[model samples]
Target: MVRILRGLAHKYFSDEEAVILFLLLVTGTIFVIWFGAMLAPAIASLIVAFILQGLVSKLNRMGVPQTVAVISVFLVFMGVLIGFIFGLLPLIWTQVSTLAGEAPRIIRELQSYLSLLPQEYPHLVSEEAVNLIYAEISAEVGHATQWLVSFSLSSIPDLVALLIYMVLVPILVFFFLKDRELIVNSIGRLLPPQRPMMVRIWHEVNLQCANYVRGKAVEILIVGGTTYVAFKLLGMPYAALLSLLVGLSVVIPYIGAAVVTVPVAVIGLFAFGWSSQFIWIMVVYGIIQALDGNVLVPVLFSEVNNLHPVVIIVAVLFFGGIWGLWGVFFAIPLATMLKAVFAAWPVQEDIPAPAQEA
Candidate 1:
């Protein structure tokens, strides 16, 4: 068996297709190992928090004292959280309550409309089909509501865990910030002596990760603020909550903005009776999204990790399948790390230099 494995490895490494297959197998194995490990999620979250702390440390290098910088960043985060709770929570609660009160009337109106459709086109469809559709819709909505309730109940444990994690994150971040250089050097020391290039690759990867995290935080704040202000000016209900959702959703990459926008628009349409007010809500979301994608992201996050859109989509889907929301949250970071690893392989090309005089 050993001799056969050796022969296969030799043959595989000699051919391009075989080499690609081998790499894929290795990557899959690594992913499985990482996922199966008990500490993976905690470690990933801690690393992310540490990266944010390091950003604060960088500010300290620019003349801000360490204590002041940490306090300032923490205060800013708290202020934003407080503002969101005060400005958005009540409005959302009110709107949601109003919508709930109106749901039966809306359903009756929908049924009436569906009934009219068959009379208007008697030969085209049957009343039973229309009834079936309505029944299905009702059933789906009921299930959705039940799921939401269950989700809220289940979230209590997760919320407790999150609070614990939050406490640990600050402690970890403090140590990370204080001994950043030592950590890097220790990681480098773990690599084999023959692989000096690994150290340089690690440095590059760290830099890319740092830039991505810092830029993303800035992008989230800008986009969230823009959304909140736009919704407020347009007299949209739950403006702050919707904006906060949109902003937090931005961390998921391609689909996050859409997830927040579509629900908000649907709720607006239902609440406002599909009038011009609903249209304005859509327009507000569009403007916020356009600015976020074209301006804020490009300007702030341009130099961060550069993964292909396809890879990001796959990672989002894959991780989201495994861990739900938290998976979605960390998808891009994991993809970034994978991209860095792939780029570090010898087969990847370096940037070409311009032709020089002899």
Candidate 2:
């Protein structure tokens, strides 16, 4: 069996294309196995939180101690959460209540608009069909809102877990930062002397993962802030809530901006009667998209990850279909990790000098 495995590895690596295919297969299999295990989501969330805490460690190097930095970062995040809940929640609750109260009127308007269509079209869509559609849509909206509320309520346990994690994270991060060199040396000792190539690959993967996480955090903040400010200035209802949605949705990549814009525009139109405010909402979203596409994405997330956009879209759809919100949230990070694995095989390239030297 050992001899047969060795022969197969020799044959597989002899052909470059075959080697690539073999690597892809191995990566996919590993992902499936890991993802299928019930612990994948929790593991992914931990990795995310670790990355954020690692950033706090970097900030600590600028002056603060790890414990103080971690506390400071957590406090800042908490302040933002409190501000959002207090400032935005009331406005959103009021607007949502108003929208609910006007639901019957909106239904009437929709019916009137639908009635104007040709009889042939109307025949294609029966009264029962329209009612079913409305009922399904309304039910879905209610379910989504309920899920959000329930998720918030459910977070109490998660918060307790987080507090526990927070205490552990800083201790972990401090040692990680201080002993990073020792960790590298320890890993090197585990590998065979001839496998410096594997060490290089590991280093590359670490850099990619770190950059991707940091870039994403920055991108989300900028986009979310822009959306919030734009809506607030235009006096759009639920500006903060919509901005949060937009910011959070961006984790899903291209579809996120559009997903956020549709509901915001629809609600604005309904609440403000398709007037200047509605138009301004459309304009704001358009500008936001333009900035994200042209400036923000290019500046923050220029790494190609070697996956086609089509592959990304499909991953988002498939994972999102199964795991819902968490799937969408982690899709890009997982994809990026997969890309790093693919790029890990030995390749000769020059290392660029630091920008200061350049």
Candidate 3:
């Protein structure tokens, strides 16, 4: 065991830079795990700043002054933020409340539909089975209602924190964008003067993950907006809410789409009742999803490394288990960054055991 441990340490940590990098990774992981919630506003601001930095750079390259570029990008960001909070959020919330109010009716209709299964397919489904299924669904719905009530009752503190974040995040994002150089340089001063491994990791991660992450943000907006417009045109109830789900469903690669389909189907069935309108809604939604996967993804992420489906799924599950929604959102980038780190990591070639004496 000691030999194994020693060999592993020697192989992985033989270099000073590798040791420093390892410590930094460990420290960062510990900090995020322990204090991430408390620093959520700052983290959110950092992400917003990072995403907007590309625009600022583009404007600067186009001969705009740095301060002017910063102000322009920040203004656009605030406008979008304000519009989303004041306009979109209320609409979604209203739909959500309406949906909740209609749940019991939907459940009753579902139960009535299910009760016919045994009559239509007596050999396949028994009456007892239908009753059991209905009971299970009712229980689940009851639990969901209880959870919603509890969540609402317990959300006062969270609402305050959200308001605080609204006030602080934009301010932090503006400064982060404007003082990015100062911040980067200050951080650089703390690191070792020579850091080839770190530099290599950063270069690869930036080349691959930055574009991928930014592309995803754009993809989300496009997919969500397109879905909202399509659903509205189709006269789908809860258009905004369903479209938002459909848009966010892009984040988890294969799984999110499949999972979110259930609600869309359920709502569609209840609204249009297996008629031509329901068929049209499903067809349009499917086309949107297909276009997003086949067309938008390739164009947006042409430069990104195509991780295998299994690897992406594993990454989503692992990181999501660790950090919940944020982990899920950054799963691909984090996985890509780890891949870069592993590629650039310094390791001593294993030394063969000494030859045994005759």
Candidate 4:
């Protein structure tokens, strides 16, 4: 066992650079896990700056001055941020509150529908099962309603933190972009002068993560905006809320769409039960999802290597468990980064045994 352990270590960690890289990774993971909440604003700023860096680089490559590029990108970012905060957030919040207010009514309607399920599918569904399911749903809805009320009452502290983030993130992002090279060089100075393994891993991670994150952002906007327009044109209630959910659903690949579909279908049924409008809404939704998967994804992620569906789902569950919503959002990128790391990781090739005389 001792010999085997030593052999494995020597095979995997033979390179000094590999050992240094491993230590760095472990240290970074520990730092994030321990202090993630306290340093959320800085981390968020770093992410935003990382995303915006591509645009800054593009502008610089076009012969624009570095300062001009930074300012231009920052202004556009601020514009979008303002619009999201003032324009979209209010609409979504209103819909959410409205939905909460009508939860009891919706629950009653759902209960009524489920009560009929046992009769309609007597062999498949039992009355007792239907009753139990309704009980669970009612309990969940009650909990959700209570949470909304409590959250509203206790949101002042959260709002203050949000405001702090709003102020600090843009400022930090601006400085990070403006001094991008300086920051890179400063960190580079802390590392060994010769670090081919780390360099390779960094490049691979950057290519995979940067492209994915940017593509996802664009995809979310397109999907969400399209969904909102479709829902509104179809006269669907809670268009903004449903659209936002639909947009964010893309982050979780298969599961999100499936989960969000339940609400969309329930709302449509409640609004236009057994009607052509409900049918049309479902049709439009299906079309949007089809186009997103078949068209938009191909265009946006043309350069990206797609992870397997199972891997993606597992990543979503694992990372989401660890970091909540942010984990879910970045699950794919994080998984891809891990894949890249392993692919680029240095390992000693096994030695071949000398052939015996034939």
**Root-mean-square deviation (CA) per prediction:** 7.3, 9.1, 2.2, 1.7
For each candidate, give its TM-score against the true structure. 0.72, 0.68, 0.92, 0.96
lDDT by residue (tens digit), candidate 4, 206-251: 8888888888889999999999999999999999999999999987
**Best prediction by TM-score:** 4
Off by over 4 Å in 1: 1-41, 65-136, 147-156, 193-195, 348-358
Clashing pairs in 4: none
True-structure Cα RMSD, model 1: 7.3
Global lDDT of each model? 0.70, 0.68, 0.90, 0.91
Separate clash counts for every candidate = 0, 0, 0, 0
TM-score of 3: 0.92
lDDT string for model 3 (176-200, tens) is 9999999999999999999888888
Rate residue 113 of model 3 by lDDT. Answer: 93
lDDT per residue for candidate 1 within 1-358, as digits (tens), equals: 9766655555435435436545655886577656744654457545655556765877888999876777676665556546656766667666655555556676777788789878998899789999998998778766655655576687898878866765665556556555666887896565445543455556666767777777777878788888888888878766766777888888887778767766686567656766888887787788778887888777876777667789889999998887777678978977786677556544423334469999
Clashes of 1: 0
> Model 1: which residue pairs collide?
none
Clashing pairs in 2: none
The TM-score obtained by model 2 is: 0.68
